[model samples]
Target: MENRNPDRATESCLVLMLKSPGRSKQRLAASIGPLAAIAAEHLCYCAFEDMAAWPGPVCFAPADEHDGGWLAARISPADAVVPQRGRNLGERINHVNRTLRMRGFERQIFIGIDCPELDERYLEQAADALGDHDVVLGPALDGGVVLMGVRHEWPDLGELAWSSTRLMADLEQFCNALGWRMARLAPLADVDTFEDLDALKRVVGEDARPARRALGAWLANDGHRPETQP
Candidate 1:
């Protein structure tokens, strides 16, 4: 299939994503204890820095009002900062998609600030895939998707099971139900568990270094997992 050519009138025709970190990744926290918050914050900071330089219009949204304003101060005025709406992750994503589509953004891609390997090249590939397919998905090792791109408004995303092992599989079914042509990218490894972080550290890239440092500190301080209480 031939890829669609980008419009010459505009400088670039991509909708980048940058969602803020606000008490996310419970499994990681469960493994690492209270320091999980610190890890999340650091991971988000690194991702935001990298995504800010992507080759398109970047749209950032925070999970809450406090984080939104905090992130707004850091991003360039050229980039757009959007507030997250809805009570659930699926709802927020669907709302963002609908809003973007209504605002004349036909082709859009949304990624989170969780994955270290979800860099510019991966996103560029997703954007390029959009030229041929109606939807593109990047699967995560944890059975969740790390990236998703669509050429139109898909209001049915709220039905998707988020943050669960069934997530990626459910998304494929959702796309098939809508008859949207789906393209896929390589599996993305995200930091949901210590195992995920360990996997990332095996390669020792700049993205994985901060996480490793944070984990090392936590381990040095708290050698064992905190005992779960009734």
Candidate 2:
């Protein structure tokens, strides 16, 4: 069912999911009005496209009611389709990670659907990093985390500050407690706030095609409209 390279799939597994658009990205939606949900949906779609293109096995769990959308039907059922659970970001992520592990994947990476700058090459790097390091983290410019990968099992990160600037630091403390060696990738921006959108525009110069296109459209829409307090 999974048309993945057997050798490659044995080494790494990718976990991805999309939450219902109307229920997610509230801050961005508040900043850009209804377009926020549209942008969030677009970002996740592009992420799925990008990650699905990778050579290894992919675990895709799209929880949205697609309303008879084509992409949902196109997804491979070989990858697990578990909807997100738990009360917060950390719990949901932990739930997903543990589920993937039960499938016997040696390395697991959890990527955010809304992080436009994320692509397949970075995922390759993370999977390769786990061969040596126990943990891998891709930090966000806004002080949140964008990607987290692991090769070794650990406790659920339910206690970490889910959306605060202190989240990565708290994770570092957790790693310290476990005595796990961690690896780092360069920090990237996630378009969670208006300021974050601005920073992403500044940092994502020439390489990220999907991200650039998404930002261009969102920026144009944002510029032509007046801001209201959400």
Q: Estimated TM-score per prediction?
A: 0.80, 0.81
Report the C-alpha lDDT of model 1 over 163-198, residue by residue, as the tens digit. Answer: 888998999988898898899889978778867755
TM-score (C-alpha) between model 2 and the true structure: 0.81
Candidate 2 lDDT by residue in tens digits, 110-214:
776657777666667777677778988888877888888888665878888888988888888899899999988878777787566555545444545664566
Q: In model 2, what are the clashing residue pairs, if there are any?
A: none
**Lowest-sum lDDT 10-residue window in model 2:** 1-10
Instruction: Give the winner by TM-score.
Output: 2
Whole-model lDDT for model 1 versus the true structure?
0.67
Best by lDDT: 2
Cα shift from native, residue 180, model 1 (Å)? 0.9
lDDT of each: 0.67, 0.69
